[model samples]
Target: MDQPPVPPAPTEQGEPVALSPPLLHAMLEASHCGLVLLDDMARVIYWNPWVVRTSGVALEEARGRRLGEIFPESAGGRLHQAVEESLITGLPAILSPRLNPHPLPLRAYAPDGRGERLFTLMMIKALPVEGGARRTMIQILDISNSVARERQLREQARELRAQAEAIGRLADHDNLTGLANRRLLSELFFKARSRAKRSGRPLAALYLDLDHFKPINDLFGHRIGDLMLVEMAERMKACLRGSDCVARIGGDEFVVLLESLHHEEDAVIGAQKLREAVGAVCRIEGKTLQVGVSIGVALYPRDGEELEMLLRQADAAMYRVKQSGKNGVALTTREEGGWPPFG
Candidate 1:
């Protein structure tokens, strides 16, 4: 058994009175927190039952041993420095878990009940006393549970943020083809128009309607129609520039936005490329399939300023192509790129 610490306390008359060592020993033995007493040389003089249970070192073994000898990992840490400062200056110091976590090799069961080895989070305090051979006392509090809860909350917050981003993407994208929906296309149109105004460049919208699509959809099932639509969207995407955006507005109808255009002729070339991509042969569900597209190109400041007006003019031009023949492209402006009034 180790001896009790008799620290001095001042009476009302300013006289130093020593606390009862036996009673102090009993109290320290029942304490929930770890309590250690060190002599003038910073060697352990008293090791309470709490310290014995937590550190797994018997009182007789801890007696007359330096803290560094008991836990070599704490030799150069803040806990060691605090003990030295308290013994020398008779002042108190605290090592918070935030700055000096796991200064001592204290073990505890993981909060998640996994039976894994977990380093106990500790808040250590070194205080100087005034009596007996014990000059300093070290107190350690277990804060592992609180730290674990804080980490769990941060992890939950990150998961919630990721879920929110995924939801936002779902809202803006078409469910079947994974292309921009009409709502997102409308929103992006305004932003692209803003860029066109700032850069003094032309913007174009290509309204495309697949020719003879309903006959195929009627012959095959809707599943095949859906798969064919996905294939066509992918081919259109592959042919367009990175800055351009393609959207499936509805069944057999799509729209392409040409955002960066140095010349209006780029819109014509892009429309031709899209017609070729849509008109290619594809094998869907082990059956050979082919399709044609009538694309109507509309340019900014020539067709109309608003997206709705541009799409309307492009739709009219596409109707003209359907009347003439399928698998062809048309422009809202005259054939010579001359300005035409909006009807």
Candidate 2:
């Protein structure tokens, strides 16, 4: 076979000789990035081998064609405007990946043919020539790996936020019954008491103890007892308003806070509803089990001013109910020489 002729080397002069067409074409073909040259009319005067390999368009097919004809989606996009601006102003224009990511729908040279090519960052610059003809040079670089890493980081951050929220809930709530624990109940009590004082409304604290809960726990396994406590919490919550607070302070013992109460009678009535709700039969593990709650009511500013004082008074009142009989409500005040029954 005959060998192709090489262009003559320049002498040891000030500037090297201009490259021949074949030499320039060979250099552009060896480039890593996609390179393209467009004339003043935006026609593809030169499309390098890199573009041919990446875009799947041969040089002969791309030559003398407008960019829109090659990539119809790029007709009015940033890539097209960048080329026009560079040619008109004789300056370079950039199409950042953040702003104009994926100007071309070029596919990746994947071995398994599974993945698409990453978005490309492009630059358009004016190419100076001796003939005073306006030409634009376009350069494209792929940035898919960076975008994928950023998305992964965002997903990790979202997971971390969700874990933090769950930790906070666990710290404030009882793990078994999913109700507010002792620590959180104390905080809520003070806040509710302050609001009641400011509004001149009564706040009622009902100290509730599940009657004969230990026998159930001893007869059945602790698992069934745990289920009973969970059911008890749900029924107690159902008997109260949304504004009311319910907390499981300890095993088989819960506290209910009724805020903005109009009268002490309302607290007695609420306690009755709670006792009835809890006394309902529960079928767990194919066995029927029944339970009752002994609730002691204490009104704010009448029973005591401070939370500890009111809690103590309510505890004493609840002891009275337990002494007389279980499954009933008792108020701190004895209006008619006996604690009236609201149930």
Candidate 3:
């Protein structure tokens, strides 16, 4: 290896000495980053030692070659376009890693012993020279670590959003049956009531209680009772419309909301369907367990304008059904003179 030439030492009188061409070339080669100089025609005029080492291209072979011939992948890419723009406008243009990551194929050894290496890229600009010819200079940088960090951050953000959604669902839904809990049901009731008031449609709230529930819990364990409640919730859901809502208020008690009813009779029909669905015989653990449901119905605007009032009236009627018979449905007659005729 030949040593690069150095500037002559100043005379004893302290006179300035112009640096020689060899010394200047040595200085450029000693740069830490990859450097390349291209003529107006985009042919490589000079390349630093860093470029040769990182790109694995020899200085003699890279000289006077076009960048496209050296790196074909960058021929029609943003890096090439940036060079053209700089040459034409006599200004520099930066290629962001976000839009154009890994524009160059040049690679550097990883710090770890692993064989993996990160790719490098460059920022390009036009450099004005003598004789009215413009040159393009490319300053290379390594961005592998930055890209990896950004990807990690995006993945973490996605996981956090998913966890937040799961928490929200847990807060608003019954854990055992996945039905709307009392809090969620209250919110839905208010929304349904607003829609009914605007469209002149009737909404029905049915308060349901499982009859003979204590005997089943005492005969079998609470586990069996819980399974029965879960099955009952599914059956109730099957009997309701898509717009309807079913909620487990507490142990052995559930609420069903029927919205957009054209007639008050529709509510009675819905309550009967629910009663039949719950009253059906369910066989669990090789033992046939027969249970019944007593439901009280309250119509919107007719029974009461508020959710609390309507719920109270429905509860009162449901108790009346339980008093008369375990498996039956009843309509509230608080506001009306007496009980309406049941079809």
lDDT of each: 0.82, 0.84, 0.85
Better of 1 and 3 by TM-score: 3
Q: Give the per-residue lDDT digits (tens) of candidate 1, residues 1-343.
A: 2346655778899898766778667788899877777888889988778667666678999899998998887897777778777766666777777677677776554454343233344433444345544377777777778778988999999999999999998999998999999989998898999999999899999899999888888999899999999999999999988888998898889999997788889898989999998898999989999999998889886777888888988888888888998888998756423466447
1 or 2, greater by TM-score: 1
lDDT of 1 at 105: 71
Q: Candidate 2: global Cα-lDDT?
A: 0.84
Which segments of candidate 3 are over 4 A away from where they belong? 1-32, 89-91, 110-121, 213-224, 281-290, 335-343
Give one clash count per candidate, in the order shown. 0, 0, 0
Q: Which ten residues in a row have the lowest lDDT in candidate 3?
A: 109-118
Candidate 1 overall lDDT versus native: 0.82
TM-score of 1: 0.80
Candidate ranking under TM-score, highest first, comes to 3, 1, 2
Tens digits of per-residue lDDT for model 3, 226-330: 888888989999998899999999888999999999899999999999988888999888879979999999988787787888888999888889899668988
Cα TM-score per model? 0.80, 0.80, 0.81
Question: Which lDDT value does model 1 have at 257?
Answer: 96
